[model samples]
Target: MALALSLKVAGLAAAATTILGVAVGFLLARASFPGRNVLDTLLTLPMVLPPTVLGYYLLVLLGRRSALGTWLLEEFGINLIFTWQGAVIAASVVAFPLVFKPARAAFESVDGQLEQAARVLGTSNTAVFFRVTLPLAWRGILAGVLLSFARALGEFGATLMVAGSIPGKTQTLSIAVYEAVQAGQDDVANTLVYIISAVCVAVLLTAGHLAPGRIARR
Candidate 1:
């Protein structure tokens, strides 16, 4: 159950971060506006801030008693706290910078002349991005995405604060390991640790292979 939930939440978080990260990354790389650096730093905060601090921020912003939380409940009957969706959100925020920074670098590294040529050839802006820019930047973007997935898979602190482990529900692999150790289930804790470590190692290796320099060398 813990493994399955961890995969599910990580997958969702990866998907969410990929979309937002790619969009924001493209914006940052292609557009220069006031406060762009500030915006970038703010978006990247979750990566540097303590996990518990991020969790507390999430609680204040999304908890039942908060205005947005109350409005969401009143309008859509949705409550984020203590839910797997909440876990997804927490993981997504934490893993966002992993995706965002690399994506920005990747997009910036793309040859702008190629995109300009495509535009000059009557291709639409969207087409140029999809065909020229995205293809060129795919390697770095993918590396970041893989890293983000791994990060999400091992997420614990914020998920704990917002989702509250409830075994078979919000209890992911990392949380399960914590619970097992706390309960003196040495065997279970060791097994979970090994699993997470192995998975993370594999992901890191894969992401390394997808790095732009490595791919270029190939």
Candidate 2:
């Protein structure tokens, strides 16, 4: 159950990260605008910020006292705090940078000449991007997706803060390991650790396989 829940949240987070990350990455790579650097820095901040700090920010943004949070609760009857969906949001925010950085690099590496040629042939920007740029950069984007999923799977501090580690509801594998150890369940902790470690290794290996240079090197 714990593994299934962990995969569920991480999977959802990864999917969301892929969509937003790819869009932001393409924008960063292809567009120039005032404050672009500032936006880049802000997007990358979660990668460097402590997990607790990120969690605190999310808490403030989504807490009941905040207008958005209150509106969400009152209008939509939807609450994120202490829910699995909250964990998904926290995981997605933290894992976004993992996908964004590599995806940006990949988008930047694609030859603009191709995009231009397509534009000259009367293709719209959206069609050109979807047909040309995305296909060429898909491998790296996929790698980033795998990395983001792994990061989300291992998220601890932020998830704990937002989701509160409820058993069978929000107790992810990482949280399960921590709680197991805290209760002196060494065997259980070890088992969970091994499971998570194996999963992470598998994800990273898949990502490495999809990385830009792997096929060229082979």
On lDDT, the candidate that comes out on top is: 1
> What TM-score would each prediction reach against the true structure?
0.98, 0.97
Residues 9-61, candidate 2, lDDT per residue (tens digit)? 99999999999999999999999999999999999998999989999999999
Regions of model 1 farther than 4 Å from truth: none
Candidate 1's residue-wise lDDT over 1-218, tens digit each? 99999999999999999999999999999999999999999999999999889999999999888999999999999999999999999999999999999999999999999999999999999999999999999999999999999999999999999999999989999999999999999999999999999999999999999999988888
lDDT of 1 at 94: 98
After best superposition, candidate 1 residue 56: deviation in angstroms? 0.4
Worst 10 residues of 1 by lDDT: 209-218
lDDT of 2: 0.96
Candidate 1 similarity to native, TM-score: 0.98
Task: Give the C-alpha lDDT of model 1.
Answer: 0.96
**Candidate 2 total steric clashes:** 0
Show pairs that collide, candidate 1: none
